[model samples]
Target: MTGGPATDEATEPYRRRIAEIWSAALGTPVTDAGHHFFAGGGDSFQAALATATVRREWGLEITVQLLIDHPVLGDFSERVARCVDER
Candidate 1:
């Protein structure tokens, strides 16, 4: 997260917000956008909770499987942003 610039301006906010949500859900500071969720102590239950939080916060329907599909925080953030834009 620190070493590289965010993928773009559109995704940076999503990335930061997701990192905060995932950090709380995972009980660890998820500062690195490239870090894998599962590798950062995330599980299915936590993923569900995190996505639920995202839904509540953004009013977006992000499936938990999206996180499973894109485990990397950066990729996940990009997808989430796309989802938001799509809606």
Candidate 2:
């Protein structure tokens, strides 16, 4: 198994990308580490849009449920790391 610790280089870009998507979709500056997508007035439709945007931007397959399951930037970054490891 190649699964191990993810370095900052690998995680930082993902976090930034996620933050950009959230900020653009919500029209708010999400500069915090504890921002919640759904709790911040992000509906299912908006989440779906985010999923598509992430896929297009990162070329990674992510479902809306996955986005819902991991709302915060930190958790979503972990998920992206796991997906990269899996691939």
Candidate 3:
């Protein structure tokens, strides 16, 4: 996954996009990347929806385990971008 302060600038937009996804799926505003999806009332079913949405929107495959592991938006978005890059 992309790392360091340099990526922060690039990841800012990704953070916004991910926050939007979280807000839409969880039905709550998620302004911070540190926010936890599960803590915000997101379950595995919602995570599946999120995975599907990401797949459809970005054309990149994301596993549910990834979401489970990276519940934080910043970490999850970094993983998503890594998967996209690898593919």
Question: 1-87, model 2: which lDDT tens digit per residue?
Answer: 232454655777777878888888888877664788888888988889888898787677779999889998777776876786676
Badly placed stretches (over 4 Å) of model 1 are: 1-7
Q: Give the per-residue lDDT of model 1 (tens digit) for 17-50.
A: 9999999999999988788999888999999999
What candidate 3 gets wrong by more than 4 Å, as runs, is none
Worst 10 residues of 2 by lDDT: 1-10
**Highest lDDT model number:** 1
Better of 1 and 3 by TM-score: 1
Report RMSD for candidate 2.
3.0
For each candidate in the order shown, give its overall lDDT on alpha carbons: 0.88, 0.79, 0.83
List the pairs of residues colliding in candidate 2.
Answer: none
At residue 39, give the lDDT of candidate 3: 87
Report the C-alpha displacement of residue 53, candidate 3, in angstroms: 0.7
Query: Order of candidates by TM-score, top first?
Result: 1, 3, 2
Compared with the true structure, the alpha-carbon lDDT of candidate 3 equals 0.83
Q: How many pairs of residues collide in each model?
A: 0, 0, 0
